[model samples]
Target: MARVYISIGSNIDREHYVTAALDALAGWFDEPLISSVYESESVGFDGSPFYNLVVGVDTDLSVAELSARFKQLEADNGRRRDVPKFSPRTLDLDILTYDLEVGRVDGVELPRGEILKNAFVLLPLAEIAPTAVHPVCGECYQVLWQAYDRDQKLWPVDFTWQGRRISQASAR
Candidate 1:
């Protein structure tokens, strides 16, 4: 089974959609390696804050199949294709990496560009897959996070899933 990482986010009814996504993932792939959820102001558009996290799974599915499944999951959770790309979403799921493969595969870019450009993606990714090397940069996620210099801000939030407290908000 190839290791796959996916980034998940939601702004509209954040908790509900996030939980739904996690539930679906668990049901479909058994237990997943999940990262702490972070809340961040919407990027690229004016909207409510989003709850973002990363999930790691081992699967035999091809990149196209995995991407299709994620797209269907988002659509099931009320994601509107007619909406603008930057608009608030009920659920947003993107394939971040499929093993260590680089470049475009099955029409999806491996090691998604957002991993380096967005705090919401990198921070949680580093938390869950710190030792995993980036396909292109050849740096471990933890090291990349340490060297990240962007001002994009985000913080962990108290979040629960399946009767367990999966993430704790910062005490500040």
Candidate 2:
């Protein structure tokens, strides 16, 4: 099985969709290693705030298959492609890393660019995989996160799943 990390976000009906995403992921793969849910301002567009998090899943699927799966899940959750590239979304799922694979593998970027460019992707990933090394950068996630730019704002929020508290917010 390939160990993979995925980023999940939703700006529309944040709670419901985020929960639904976690549920759907749990159904397909092993129970995921979840990160704290975070609320953050939208990047590249104007829209409502989004709830974002990272999940670790061990799957036998290839990167191409995983990419297709995510797209299907997003569509099922009401994601609209007619909107602009950075417009609001009901659900957004992107593969962050697929095992130790690098560059484009099977049409999917092995290590997603946003993992370093966006706090929404990096923070939660660092939280869950502190010691996991970046395939390209060759540094553990915690170290990369320590050197991250803080201009883009994001914070953890209270989130529950399956009647269990999975994330807790802190005073900002």
Candidate 3:
């Protein structure tokens, strides 16, 4: 199984949508490593702030399969692809890193969009997956994340879903 990391965020009914997505992900992957929820100001959009988090899941599914499932989760929670890029969303789940494998889909690379450029994805990612090196950049998340002078808008929240709990043995 490959260990994949995903960045998830939402600006509409964020807490509810994020929790539901987490629950859905647990049904698909092996044990997941969840990060704390962070509220951050919208980056490329002019709308409400967003709640963001990163999750690391060990899965037998291929990257394309996982991405498809994530998109489906977004659609199930009312995400609309027809809208402008960076538009406010009900749920946004992006694959940040998938083990050390890197390749392309539809001629565009994996981690295809600008999801990693935004600190909202990097901050919580650093918090949880600090030592995981960037597959493309070869830099640790903490070093890369802290080097950027991103606005300190992301704040932590205390909401988490059950059932996908990190195991005690795995926690060690």
Residue lDDT tens for model 1, 1-172: 9999999999999999999999988987867999999999999999999999999999899999988998999999899999788899999999999999898999998879999999999999999999999999999999999999999889999999999988999975
TM-score of each: 0.98, 0.97, 0.86
Instruction: Write model 3 residue lDDT over 1-172, tens digit each, in one string.
Output: 7877888889999878988888898777767788878777898778999988888888887777877888789999999999999799999988877777677753326653453577778877788888888787888889988787855566676574675332121211
Alpha-carbon lDDT, every model: 0.94, 0.94, 0.77
Candidate 2, 1-172: lDDT as tens digits: 9999999999999999999899999999877999999999999988999999999999999898989989999999999999789999999999999999999898888799999999999999999999999999899999999999769999899999999998999999
Clashes of 2: 0
Clashes of each: 0, 0, 0
**Cα lDDT for residue 73, candidate 2:** 92
Q: Using alpha carbons, what is the TM-score of model 2?
A: 0.97
Give candidate 3's total backbone clashes. Answer: 0
| Clash-forming residue pairs, model 2 | none
